[model samples]
Target: MSQQRIGDRYELVEELSHGGMGDVWRGYDAVLDRPVAVKLVRQQSVTSPELAEEFAKRFRREARITARIQHSGVPQVYDAVLDDSLERLFLVMELVDGVPLSAYLRNGRPLPVAWAAAVVAQVATVLSYAHDVPAIHRDLKPGNILVARDGTVKVLDFGIAAILRTDVTKLTATGTPIGTYQYMAPEQVRGGRITPQTDLYALGCVLHELLSGRLLFTADSEYAIMFQHVNAAPQPLRELRADVPPPLEELVLHLLRKAPEARPADVQEVYERLRPYLPPPGSEPAPNEAGPDGVPDPTGLFRNPYAPRSRARAEQRPPAGEGQPAAQPVPAPVPGALREEIKEAYAHADALLDEERFAQAAEVLGGVVERAARALGPESRQVLELRTHRAAIQLLGGDYRSALPEFDSLADAYGRTAGPGSEQARACRAQAARCRAELGQVTEALAALEDLLALVRSVDGDVSEEAVELRRDIGMLLLAQGRTIESRHILEPLYDDLCVVFGPDDELTVEIAEALALIRLGLDASSP
Candidate 1:
C-alpha cells in the first residue's frame, strides 16, 4: 500500500522495511520540517467491522501512547491517522538516526563490557519509565535498538508492540507468531504471563553476546535455537569467553536462567548493577580504541566474576578475579564431516515436515537417525539422538496406529544405539509403552517394559538416575491391575532403593514414601 499522506502535513518518503503486518517508511512533516517514521498497517492484520474499528483505534492511539512515554531513549510520536479510504492507517514517529544494534553486533568483534553496560543502562532506564507508566516494550532486542553516531542509543517500536499484548490476540485468525524468538523469555515462549524481569533476561543475553561475541546458545536452525533458550542451561559466559569476569559471569547467567524468578525484578536493578562498570567520565580513551577485538583490559577488568569488580560483592572474589590468561577462541569450521552430513539430512528433513509431507519427512529423518546412530557410535549420549525425538513428533500426528509399530522398532534400535540402561534409550522405550497404553494395550505395554528392564539389568553400563524410578513404574502398573500382593512386594523394594539413593528429605523420596504409605494403609485396613 502506498503511504497515504498524514493530515496533509507529512509526506511519506520511501519504504524502509516490511514485516508480516505492514511496511515502514520515512516521511517528512511539511509544517515541522523534520523527518518522521510512518508504519502503514497491512490489510491482512485486519478483518470484520469490530476488528477494523479496534485497529483504527489502536492505530490512531499509537501516537498518543508513544507520546505518553517521557524518555530520551523512546522515539517521539508525531501523529497517527487513517488514510483516504479509511482502509489504511499509519503512525508518525521521530526518525531515529543510525543503524540498528543487530547490524552493529554483526561487525564480528566482542563489544567492550563497559560500552555494553552503558548501552544497557539506557535501555533499563527506558524500560523502568515505560513499565512504571504501566507500559512494556513486549519486544526488546538488538534489532529494535538504534545506535547513533554520537553513541546515543535509542529504542524504537513501542506503539505496535504495546497493542500486541491484547490486540494481537484479538486478531487470532491471521496472526503470525509475533516477536523475534531468540530474545523471548521462557514465559513469553510458552504463552504464559510476562513481567518486567522478562525484558531483563533478554538484556542478559544481549550483554553476554556483546561481551563474548558469540551466541549464548546455538543450534542447527532457528527453532532449535529457540528450543535451547527455553530448555537448555546456557554454557557460562566465563567458560565461553575467559575474559568475562567471574562475578559478572555468574550475574549474566543468573539473569538468563530459564525461570523469570531467577532474574532481577526490574530495570532499576539492572541499572544499579551496570552503573559501576561504566568507566568514569573523561578518563576513557579515544573512540578508535573501540577496535573489533574489544577494548584491551590491561588489568583484566572482568577476568573473573568474583573479583573485587563491583563493590557490592568484591569480598566474594576468588582471590580478586585473577585467573589464567584468557583461553584462545575455538577455531571455526570445526571439522568432522559426519556431523555436517547428518545436519544436512536433518535440515532437509525438517523442511519436508514444514511442507506437510510427513512420509518424506520420516524417510529423511530416518536416514538421519540411522547415520547419527552409527556416527555417534554405540551407547553414546551425544545430542544427535534428538533426531529420533524429532522424527517421533511427525509419527504421532495422524499416523499413530501405523506409527506404533515403528515406534517399537525405534525403541529397540535406541536400546542398542543409546544402550538400554541409558536415559535416552529408556526414554524411547517409555514413550513406546505410553503409545501402546494409550491404544489400550496395557498388557503389551507392561510386557515390553519388563523385557526392557531385564535387558537393562543384564547390561554392564552406566544406569541413569532414571533407573532408580523405573522400579516405581513397575509397582504403579502392578498396583493398578489388582495384583496387590505383587505390587506391595515391588513397592517395598523400590521404597528401600529410593531411601538409599535419595535421602529422606529429597523430593523424590517424599513421593515414594507417599505411595508406599497408601499401599501399607490399604493392606492394614482391608484385604483389598
Candidate 2:
C-alpha cells in the first residue's frame, strides 16, 4: 500500500488528498502513457463484507455509466477495480490540471456573467446527458468543477452517482444528508426522492457563487446548511453581483426554489433558456435569461409555470388542403358510454396541462394517445398525435423543443399514412425544415429535405412521377444555397424525364422546365 502500483498498470506516484470515504492519488498509467487520478476507498467505507460487495458494485456502476458519456467538460473514467486484499477499491480517471472553480472565483474580479453561464451550460449539458440515461451527478459544487488553463471547464465526481436503474439501492443514504448541504435540493435535504432537478439546484448555488465571488448560502454547521436548503432561498444574485444580467438573476432564483417542482424541470431547460442569451451556444446571451415581470424565465418561454395557465395559444389550424383532417361524422346511435369516456380523457388531459401538471398530463394523455393511435391506426391524422396544446405543454415542461422533432417524426409518419406526394406529407417535411432552420441547425435542416427525398424514393419506385417531383424540391434548396452544379444535375434529368412523362404542358413539367431555363439564363449571362 506504500507508494505502489495497484491492479497492475497504475503506478501511484503521490497521495493527492483524503476524505471520509477514500484517499485520492496522482498516478501514471504506463499502458496509456498518461497521468490519472486514482481514488481508493478507505478501509472504513469498505470494511464490512456486505458493504465491500456494495462498494465494488457502486464503484463499477460509476465507471460503467461515466464511460458511455463523452463530454469535453467531464473527466473520463479509465478503470475500476478491487485491490487483491479486498481492503481497498480504486478507480482511475483522467488527471485534470486546472484550478477548481472556487479558486478561479476567488480572484478579486468576479467571473463574467457569460463565462459563468458558459461553464454552467457545459455542466448542464453533461448533467442533461446523464439525466437522459437516468443518472444524477448527486454532488455538484464549484470545487468539483475544474477550470483548465485553456478556459475549458470539466465537471468532476460521480462518486455518489445515482443511476435510475430501479433496483433501489440508488439514493445516497445518510440519515440527514449527502452532497454539500448548501447546494442540496430541498428533497435531497429532506431525505425524499431525488431527481435530475436536484443536481440543477446544486448548479444554481455554484453559479451564484461564481458570479458574486461569494457563497450563495452558508451556515456554521452542516445541520444548519441542510435546514437552510430545505426551507430557504439564497439571496438573489443581483443583490450580490449588481451587474448580473436580469434574466440570469431570475434563473438562479428559480433554481433556488425551495420546492423542486417550482424549478426548471431539467438541466436542459435551465441551459436552453439561458443558451439563447449566449452567443455561439458557448457564450453569453444579450439581455440575459429574463421574463415578463422582467425577471428571468429560465423556465424558458415554452415551459409553462406552476400557476394555472389562464390563456393558452389558440390552436393553429393546419394549412388549408394540408393535413387538415376531416372532422369525423357523428355516427347515428353512437353509444353515450364510449363518447363520455373519450370526452372525459381529453378534458382531463387538458385540465392537467392548464394546471401545469405535466407529468400527470403525460400519464393521462399518454394513455389517450396510445389508445387513440391504436384505435385510429398510426397513420391516421386523427390518431393520438402530439398536436393541440400537448406540444406546447411538452415545450413548457422543458422536455427540449417539442415541436421540432415531432414535426419531423410526424412528417415521416404522415408520409406513411398519406402517400409521399400527398399535400400532408409535403407540409410536414416543410414544417420540420422550417423549425430546423429557425433553430439554427442549417445542416440538419438540409438533412430533413434529404429525408423527404428518401421517403419519396421509397414510395415512388425509380423512374416514377413522384420521384422526379421530390428531386425538384431537393434541387430548389440546393440551387438557393449556391450548389448549382448538384442542383442542375438533379433538375436536368427530372426535366428530361418530365418532358416525356407529362409533356411540356403539365404543371410539374413546366416547373422543372422553368427552373432549367432560369439556370441556363444565369449561366449564359455570367459567361464572358
Q: What lDDT is reached at residue 136 by model 2?
A: 76
CA lDDT, candidate 2, residue 202: 91
Question: Global CA lDDT of candidate 1, please?
Answer: 0.64
- Clash pairs, candidate 2, are 247-289, 247-290, 277-285, 278-284, 278-285, 291-295, 302-396, 303-396
Residue range 96-208, candidate 1, lDDT tens digits: 76667776577657776666776777777788887887666767888778766445678877756645444342112234345566777777666667677777778887888
Q: Once superposed on the true structure, which residue ranges of model 2 sit more than 4 Å away at CA?
A: 19-21, 43-47, 107-109, 161-176, 276-528
Q: State the displacement of the C-alpha of residue 73, model 1, in Å, after optimal TM-score superposition.
A: 0.9
Return the lDDT, model 2, position 373: 55
Q: What is the lDDT of residue 477 in candidate 1?
A: 79
lDDT of 2 by residue, 1-528 (tens): 124888877778678777644677888664654568998755444557786677667667767887767776678888887776666678788888766666665554556665667678767877877787666777788767776644456787775434212222212434434566667787876566778788888988888876777777677977676777776657887777778878889998888887778889888789877775444522233565331231122222123323343442333434323443334433244246534655676687676567565644544544456555555455554442434335445445544344666655665555455544565656566555655555556575677567656666676764565456457767877777778778898898887777787788999888878888888888888899
Badly placed stretches (over 4 Å) of model 1 are: 1-4, 19-22, 41-43, 84-86, 164-175, 286-289, 292-528
RMSD of each: 29.1, 24.6
